[model samples]
Target: MRDLKPWLALIFKRPGRLVMGGALIMATLLSGIGLLAVSGWFITETALVGMLLAAGVAATINLYVPGGAIRFFAVSRTVFRYLERVYNHDTVLRLLTDIRVALFQSLASASRRHRRQLTGAEWLSRLTSDVDALDTLYLRLIAPTALAALVTALVVALTAALFDIKTATLVGLVLLVAFLIATIGTYLRTRHLAARQSDCQESLRTAVIEYIEGFAELTAAGRTGKHAAWLMRQAHQVTSEQAQADTLAGWHLAGSHLLINLSAVLTLWAGFALFRAGVVSGPVLVLLPIALLGLAEIYAMLPDAFGKLGATAASASRLNRDCQAEEPARDTGAQGLPANAALFATNLAVKHPGHAPLFTHFELEVNAGERVGILGYSGSGKSTLADVFSGLLPAAHGNLATRDLVYLTQKTVLFEDTLRANLLLGAPNASETELWRILEVVELADRFAPEPDQLDTWLGSSGSRLSGGEARRVALARVLLNPAPVVILDEPFTGLDAGTRARIAKRMDLLLEGKTVISLAHGPDALPGTDRVIHLPG
Candidate 1:
């Protein structure tokens, strides 16, 4: 239950919509009960009046009031049903949007290593299935449970007034037990199975995706049969859990119905004693019994909802765990940085969590408006150091400070959007001329200029439409467009031929004249123009 606190707080943010939707649901239920109770009263009165008139006695009955009420209840039931569907569905959509936005923001702030621990399929489950489980928390669990309790109390109170305290108390007890059977009992029976259902689904989804992705390799190795057998078992387990949950919910639903019907029977039997004592009229006797029976409609949805409550809590727990943000260690050197220094580092240590330090007690400083390059081979800690300097990954022990900067990571990433949109991420207000000028600097203007859509051409997923060098250049163009005081480029000239790299490197020198630059590459040929180069010991 504690796992649900954060998500519950988020859901409660839209109290106004929740209140309105609950009111509509309440009205719909009450109208349904009223319709049945009043119709019973009207029919009994009509029959009694007819008997009296036929016996050579005169009788008078008011048809207009009950008839009008029946009509009103009938119409309101339809209208409120429609309105509830429209309004509540809209609320669910808005809630989904809120949840997705918060989730993405949290993911953005989380440690990259933690996020990388999850497969792509697991992340997809969190975004789609896990989020879906939460979006309906109000409609499925909260509102129905609350409205059922309230409506039951109202019916019991009415019974007390119309019949007698003793009868109403007995009827209330029966309905209370029914409510528990539908809600608490259902949850208890299905909790373990339901809680693990999401996990099983995620496991199955990951298995299926892995199987498809590795189908060719496994087939070539003559191991596809074994992998497929494992997938079958995983899928079967998921199906078995679902079936068990459904069976439990179904039994609880039937039990609740039985108890409610028993209450109606008790009401009828007790009404007979009251009628013989001339304590209540015949029509009134039938009314209370019919109203008791009407409660079955509300309790019907409770068992299924409670059955899924365990799953919802599990989903919330997973989301909360995955999105937790760990604050990085503060850089104490920031306040003492020299005015002319673009970057300052002291006693720096670099490593991933649970791994030995890659490099420690290292120090470096770059002055403002200077070009400095750091050289290291493949196995060295060059990229790890780059991450620490850029603040993507925190250092084990370090004091570091940097002026505002833009870092072009060693990996190239571009969205499946228009080329213009991709570039705009770096500088949203960059003009067309500025864009063209940057592309020309990277010698890519000619490549895209001949395309049908020009700048608006689609980049495909991760810029799949472009070759390796072209994609690398597009990423470079974006980083260069950023107006930061310092620039960190890790293997920025990757995939470009030597001739192309020389041309771009020369052009970048003039373009970056007024900003400090820190570039990392394996050797001097791979580096751009630099005032001085630092080599790390192998």
Candidate 2:
């Protein structure tokens, strides 16, 4: 409900668009009646030459009037769609921003121990998908739907006036009945749609993000076949569900058209019979069918829109559910840490799924000048611990807190961006010396890749073209350049050769000597043997 307010405000803010849209609908309805009126005259008027000619002229005008009315309606819809985009986008973006912020805090709030229950995809999902899920409401449910309903009602009323009061009333009654039925049917299925759509979308998002993020791991770690196969399976599942949703929506729309068509036919037949019986006039008879218009079809459409909205609502509800899965950890990590230190995490415990505990009651304290190595057996929870201490995982049970922590993962996540642009994330206004200094840390100072024109070299996604060791060093360089108090590494030297690792290690030790460090060990020889080895009690 709280999230609904901003989207509602979006509909209200563009008064000009709303008015234009309303007028278009009103005019189109008027045009529908004019068409029936003129067509009826053409049908009924006989060989009174003057009456016939007048009728012909009126017919021509009415034919053109409907087109003009449609043009206005189309133009109005276009303008409305534009405003809808702005307002809807803004509202959803705002919600997403707020959600991400909350999740960020939640990540901090959950003690460091909670980090094991999360994946890169899960975190990214919270940041991107959950917010995106709410967008379904804006795009599918709100604007077009409201406009469709308002216009349909207005057109029905105007058509009633053009025909006899009785005929008008009948037409309205028929449209109302059809719409009510359609809406009811749609309403019945809406909950199903919501649940299905939310699940499918979440799965799709999780699969895609995980595939992208773990592609390298899957390749280097030999999980590619398994991972790719799993992705195919997930994709198929999402597609199947989406196809079902679309099929249902399409059927609903078609049924609506049938209902609308039926009402139009009934109104025309009844009206014409009355006119022949000398109970009504030509204009009324013609206008009755014409008035049973494009708008009337909206009665049928309302259900589908509502159904779609229900789906979006389902998605939003699920996302919110994810948010409230465990209430926001009320503890703020910002309390006792001095801002000047490189990084800090206190009493951080990380746990994993299908486990009693990753590390029971973990405690980590890194001060101004120290390098701490986090050690654990294979699956013993080194990376999980690293993630916890760095504020990536929020649910770890024990007093989790960090100050100025920067995480350098084994896989260097570089966009298809330039050398300078990538570095800009750390320090946007870095000078030449700064860049050179950063390059020095990674031992890439004098060696330049000539493939890219200059500092604006576009290293492809995940720094693919570069060797794994080079990419790892590049990420390390980025961390070195950032003026942060703490540097956290999760097997940052994974793919590096022994010499390269040793060289980079020496430079890092000197540069990070005064800063707190937490590096997760991969092999027994991983890292330069830090000040402390955190053990995982199996």
Candidate 3:
């Protein structure tokens, strides 16, 4: 329950939608029960009238009222059912959108170290399956449980009015037991199994992905057959556990139904006594029993939903752990940047948590509109420093200040989207002409211009449609598109040939004329044209 608090808060954000959807569901359930109870009463009334007419005794019955009510409930059940499906499904989709947006925002704010600890497969499960579980939280678990209790109370109260307090109390007690069997009993019987099954499915997904990714290596080592067999066994175990949960849910469902039917039988038996004593009429006697039977429809949904409750909780726990929000500890000693400086750092210590400090008492200042380069070897913490300056990472101890900036990381990242869309991420309001100009500056305009879609050409996943050099240039082009006063580039010219690097570097000066550029690279050759350069010791 604690694990579900955050997600439940998100789900309840749309209170109006949830309330309306619940109303529709309630209406549908009531109409179905009303239809059944009224039909039974009408039939019993008609039978009594026919016998009275056959015995030559006058009898008056309002056929029109009962017939009209039956028609009304029948039509209402169908209409409400359709509306509930449409409205609730739409609400679920909107909630899904809200949840995904919130999840992504939390992930974006999380530290790089935390994110780095997660595998791609683990992230996928959190985003897809875990988020998917929360989307149905309102519709599946909350609404049904609440409405079932409310509807049952209403029905019990109706029984008291139609029959008597003693009989209603008896019927209510039976229903209470049936509700417990369907809900808590199912949950207790299958909670561990369901939670374990959810985890097993995730593990299997990760295993299969790893298996396919390492298939060639496994074959080379002659272990492919063994690994494949292990995956098969895991998959089979997941299926078996799912079967066990379903079996338990089925038994609980059967028990609940049996108890519900018994309640109906009890009502009918009790009603006869009341009917004989003139405490209840024949039509009223039939109505209570039929309405008791109508409760089967509501109880039918409880067992299946409660059985999966454990899995939903597990999913929420995982999401909360993975994407939990954290506020960085602010340093009171930190100072603001000087008016002329684009970036300033003083008494800075740079390192990851629980590790040796990379740099202590580091001091640096770059004036606005200065193109400064930092040169170091591959393992010299050049990228880490770049991260600190760009604020992607925090300094372990120090005062650090920077103007608004855009950073191009050491790794080239491009989405599976159009070429134009990828570039627009840097500057959303950039015109097509500006996009083509940036592409030209990066020496990619000619490469894409020959294609039919040109700017609209699809860049496959991670820009797989382009060569390594081409992808690197596309990333560089995106950074260059930003209008930030400060620009941080780490290994900006990676994957490009020397001549191409020189060409892009030459054109970069005019493009970034007014900006403060801090470019980190492995060697002097890798550094672009700079006003001054700093070299870090090994």
Candidate 4:
């Protein structure tokens, strides 16, 4: 339960809503109990009066008050139940919005290596399914459990006041035992199964996403059937785990029902014995049994709540771990970069985990308005050096300072949005004229010339609607739009044809004029207008 403290804090951010929702839930449940008790007493008392009347005895009975109370209880229960659903769902949705934003921000700030450890599918699971699981924490676990406790207390007090300490004690003990048994037993029985099911579900999601994204490659390789079979196997595993969890939950629910019914029967039998001995009244006897019966609704939901506890806790734990920020060593003496310098590094070291240092004792200095090209083999640390320059990766053992820089990686990424929106990511306030200038420079202006929507035309996922060369051009156009002092292009022409590459290189000098540019590629010839070239050892 303590694993939920962070999420609980989010809920409490809107205290008024939380309290109001809980209050409504309490009212709804209490109204249901009141309706049941009142109906039972009214029917019993009316029958007694009828019996006396049939024996030729005059019996006075007031049906107005009890009938009115029943009506009030019924109407209030229905109204409160509806209100609770509406208000609670709205609050949950707001909480989910906050949660998604926070989760994305946290991941965005994480180290590049750490972020890479979580695959696209895993991230989707965390953001969607895991967050959805936390949604049920408040309504299912907290509210129902709290309400059950309150109901138990009220029942015990009522019984003690109307009957005796013995009866109240009996009811309290029965309820306490039943609750512990249901909660503990269900948790123990389904905890492992629930965790397995969660893992299986995540695996299935990952497999499906992979199949969708790689369908073309699979078909081309004649392995589509193999991929389909793999997906089926993952699906079967998820289904099997789900079946086991459901079976356990069903058994626990059945057991909970049996216990509640047994408690009611015992209470009724004891009440009848006391009534015959003149220790209990008919109305009180009937009320006691019916009140216990009212609790059946509360206990009925316990099995599911406890059964899901394991999965919820696992999800919470995973989120907590992923959201945790790495404590980078603070360099107290670190100073800002000089105004005239684009970037400076001295004795810099960078390495991936469990691997030899990629760069050691690396020293670099780039003045303002310099065009530098880094030529290295495939396994060389050219891209990593670019990452260090852009502050995406930290150096292990040196002082590094750089002005803000725009980076264009080898893979061009574009969201499913209008061309205008994608460009706005670089310069939010840039005018349409500015957008056209950059697009024309990147050789993409003619691509949109035939479309009526022009800049407003939607770019499909990852710019799927565009050709590979066109997507790279759009990405470069976005980078060119950024108002940064330094520009880092890492293999920007990897997928383009030779003619397209030459054309883009010839235009690079004009587009990146008066900026400190560091272009990383396989050879110095890959980037034109290179004033100097540095080659790294393999």
Candidate 5:
């Protein structure tokens, strides 16, 4: 539960909305109970008056006051209920927006390796399903439980005024016992099951995503049926857990219902005895039973609300574990890079967590306007070096400094947006003419020129609509648009054909003439012109 503090704080960050929502909920419940009690009294009084008139007994009874009171309660209940729903839901939506932004920022600030371990599907579940579960925490658990408490108090107070203190004490005791039984019993029975169900659901989500993403590979390997069977088995487990929770919830609801009805009956019987003894009025006797009925609106939600406790807690725990920010070690008192050098590094060391150092005591320097190639085979820390240079990964020990630079990774990642939108990421204020110039340098302008939207064409998720080579070019064009003085290309020409690679290389030389470039690749032929080649030690 301690893990939930941060998330809970976010929900209550704007206390005004929470308080207003709670006040409205209380008003809704009170109006509903008032309506039921007044209607019951009015009916009883009217019946007695009708009998008196039939018997030729003079009686004075005004229907206008009680009738008007009933109307006021009914209308207020409806109005307050509508207002409560609208305000609370609007507040919840705004709270969810804040939560999403906070979660994204936490992820962005997390260690690169940690972020890498979270697959795209896992992220989608956290951002959507986990966050959605939080809504139930406020609406179902907190609001309903708090309102139930308030309703119980009002019930006791009303009983005391209409009857004796002893009777009111008994009523309060009965309500408290019933509520505790319903809430605690439901929680103890369903908490583990709810947690298991949530886990199974996440597992099923991961399985379905894998099956879709790897459909071609699984089919080719003749393992698609096996994966599908596993997914079905997971679905069956989830359904089985859900059935157990539902069954337990049903039992709890039955028990609570019986207890409430018994309490109401006991109260009415005692009041009826008093009425027969000429100690209580007939209208007052009718009011006790109907008042308990009004309380049904509050206690009715207890079983389901407590049953959902486990699922909500599980989601909160998962989100807290994943989204908590970890501040990286800062390099204090480190000087800025000199204006004359593009990059400088000395006694550099880099390592992954719980692993031996990938590189140690590495040394490198590149003068301004120098095109350098870092040649290395796989597992030789080529990409790690790029990460270090781009400040994506911190150094274990080193003095490293560099001017602001744009990095193009080996994988070309593009969002599901327009071509123009994707390009704007590199240079937000770039003009159309500048965009066309960069595209021409990458040799993709002609391909897009014939299109209706030109640069406005929408690129599917990760640029799935484009061929591998075209995506690479689009990424390169984006890099070219960056205003940074230095650019790091990690295997920039990976997917291009030999002809296209040569053409892009020649064009890159012309376009990036005076900028410092660090091209990391397997061989020297990747970048056409290079001032020096530094081979990484394996």
Candidate 6:
């Protein structure tokens, strides 16, 4: 139980507005219930008037007034019903969005570390299904349930005042018992159902994402049957969970009907005896149980009453659990880039759960304006070293420092935007003079190739629309635009031909002047001017 106090506390932060909205909804529900009670009054009053001769026309006029009251209630309900839908839906979606944003922020720290442990399905569950399920909280559970119970209680009070005020008072006591039995019983029983439903959604998401992402590979390797069998298993598990929840819910539903039936019967027995005693008229007797019938219908929908509490609990649990990985920082919350930097790392080490140490007491230093080459066989800790140096790695034990560093991995990254957008990402407000100056250094001197506004041309997937060497150089150009004090490159020669490679090597010296540079190289022979070269033992 992580605790849901903070999340529930959000409900009261907008107290005046929430209460006002709730009050309006309550007013609407009461109007509808009042129409029911007033119609019952109309029936009873008309019946009683029929037995008297001289009272006929005057009684007809009296009945018509309550009918007019009933009509007014109907018109008001219809008017508010339209407004309620718009406002309620907006409130539900806003709540859902808030839940989603909170979950994202909570998971932000842990997600980067346990990427594999947090599956697509679990994410989808929280983002889509779990949060969506919370709509039941405000819509079905809180507003409608609160309104129904309150109005029904009022009707019960009205019934009691009818046939001897004392008898009506007893019915009020019975209404209390009826409400307690229905509301509390359903709450204690079905509250856990939301959390269980959230879990079910998570499981379904995982199975479905796994089934979809592996579809092509499974088809290629002819393993469709195996995947299908796994999906079937998950489906069965989901069904089993559903059946269990429904079984519990079935008990509550049965208990609700039983309580309502008992309340109605009790009201009848109590009210009927008074009718025969001349203590109450036939009209009062007939309407006493009808008012209880009106309340009985409302109490039967108790599941809708307490549903939001369960949803809030479920969402709060999901968010708190996901955010457990977020570590409170002891260091000041600043990641400033060092200028004119000399990189230093001494006794650096990092180990993973199932793997041996990537670096055990490793050490390296790069002097300003010096180019260092890192050559190693695959799996010899090349990219891992770059990650550690660039503040992206969590160290087991190590010291790593640089004032400012521009690091690029072997895998080229492109955004879905224009060429200028990707380049300006590092320094958003760079001038045209600064942009053109760096572009010429990378030997991409042309202002435009196919478009009049070359820099402004719409690029796809981190400039995948550019050729391989062009994309590499363009990515490099973006790094240049930042003008960081340190530049680190991992396998930048990949996907380039010999001419392109030579051109990049030529461009690197011109573009990376006065920067502390490190390159994880494929071959030492390719980068001749690299001042310090360290080769991993082959």
Please, what's the RMSD in Å of model 5? 4.9
Estimate every model's Cα lDDT from 0 to 1: 0.92, 0.62, 0.91, 0.84, 0.85, 0.68
Number of the top lDDT candidate: 1
Q: Per-residue alpha-carbon lDDT of model 6 for 283-348, expressed as tens digits?
A: 556655665666655665664455334545776677566655645321111233245447776677
User: Residue 486 error for model 4, in Å?
Assistant: 5.4
Q: Give per-residue CA lDDT, model 4, range 1-538, as digits (tens).
A: 6767888787668778778888999999999999999999999999989999999999978999999999999999999999999999988888788777777777766778777778888888888899999876778887788888888898889888887888788878878877876788899999888877877787789889989999999999999998899889888888887888888888877776677777788788888889999998788789888988888898888888888888887888888887766654323122656667788888889877677999999988888899888999998988887877776776777878777788998668898999999999889999999999888877788889788999998999999998887888888888889988789999888677778788878887887889999899997657757888988998
The C-alpha stretches of model 1 lying farther than 4 A from their native spots are 53-57, 60-65, 276-279, 329-339, 352-358, 376-379, 416-460, 463-485, 493-516, 521-531, 536-538
What C-alpha lDDT does candidate 2 achieve relative to the native structure? Answer: 0.62
Worst 10 residues of 4 by lDDT: 327-336
Candidate 4 regions off by >4 Å?
Answer: 1-3, 204-243, 273-281, 328-342, 349-360, 367-382, 394-399, 403-406, 417-460, 463-538
- Per-candidate TM equals 0.84, 0.63, 0.86, 0.77, 0.77, 0.70
User: Any runs in candidate 5 off by more than 4 Å, and if so which?
Assistant: 118-121, 211-233, 269-280, 327-344, 349-358, 365-381, 394-407, 417-460, 463-538
lDDT of 5: 0.85
Clashes by residue pair, model 5: none
lDDT of 5 by residue, 1-538 (tens): 5756778888878789888998999999999988999999999999999999999999878889999999999999999999999999998888888888888888777768677667888878888899998855677777888888888888888877877687778888888888886788899989989988887798789779979999999999999999899888889888888888988988888877776777688788778777888878999998987888788778888898888778878888888877766665534112556658888888889988788999899888788899999999989999998988887777888878877789998778898998999999899999999999999988989988998999999889999989998998899899989989899999999788888899889988988889999999988877667889999887
Ranking by TM-score: 3, 1, 5, 4, 6, 2
For candidate 3, the lDDT comes to: 0.91
- On TM-score, the leading prediction is 3
lDDT tens digits by residue: candidate 3, 336-367: 88888988888999998788999999999899
RMSD of each: 3.8, 7.7, 3.6, 5.1, 4.9, 6.0
RMSD of candidate 2 to the truth, in angstroms, is: 7.7
* Model 3 alpha-carbon miss at residue 222, Å: 2.2
Q: Could you tell me how far off, in angstroms, the CA of residue 155 lies in candidate 4 after the best superposition?
A: 2.9
